[model samples]
Target: MYMLRKFRKVFSLIILTTMMSLGITAPGYAAMLGTDDILAGDNLQQQRDYVKELLNRDEVQNQLADMGVDPLEAEQRVDAMTEQEIQTLSSQLEELPAGASALGLLAFVLVVLLITDLLNLTNVYNI
Candidate 1:
């Protein structure tokens, strides 16, 4: 009978300690279960936010710098781009001709020169 009383005391202490350690707040804890489910809303902002997130990636920014694209200007362009444009940007990044990333800036400059050459807007190397 003495052991039974001690066992009850221990069990009561364990329940008390468990409740205290769980930090049960006095208000509205049970009310949360009664709340209605949330409904979905318009998603345009989500699309814009997702595009903005893509522009923040390391590889896209790195590739921009490699291709002589100014960091700020590229950022501006990205910001100005439509969601459709941003959608295409990731694939376009991969299609950049392979080369040294930093030197890619110089390569971009070279590409511009070639464009002018083809257009006959500039002389070849001798000029």
Candidate 2:
């Protein structure tokens, strides 16, 4: 009985020592995430969805076609973009004007032509 008790004590001591050594060698880490850190992942997904939706639009698709860009390839490229690039693109999209009138575009073109004519870059106008 005494021998059994001694063997049990030695076994317990070995287990305790092994556990302590493992605890020292392999420590676990935990940290509290901030709201931004948690939401950033969701925001990236939302941005990707927004870009894909834009790519799916008929007008956008037609524009891409006219520009010789394949809509599917553009979408794949968007998918391949890094988080920072996606965020920057999303922010730029937000900053774009919601709509522009044909008259506004015509005026902008006329202004550009006038500027070029004044600089003698082109004799588009006999001014």
Task: Write down the lDDT of every candidate, Cα atoms only.
Answer: 0.53, 0.67
Provide the RMSD of all predictions against the true structure, rounded to 1 decimal.
16.0, 13.4
Q: List candidate 1 stretches off by more than 4 Å.
A: 1-42, 83-127
Model 2, CA-based lDDT = 0.67
Give me the displacement of residue 44 in model 1, in angstroms: 2.7
lDDT of 1 by residue, 26-65 (tens): 6754534322332112243454455446445676567656
Question: Among all windows of ten consecutive residues in candidate 2, which has the lowest summed lDDT?
Answer: 100-109
Tens-digit per-residue lDDT, 35-113, candidate 2: 9998989999999887677667776677666655566766776686679867866666665566632223223334544
In candidate 2, residue 108 scores what lDDT? 35
- TM-score against truth, every candidate: 0.31, 0.53
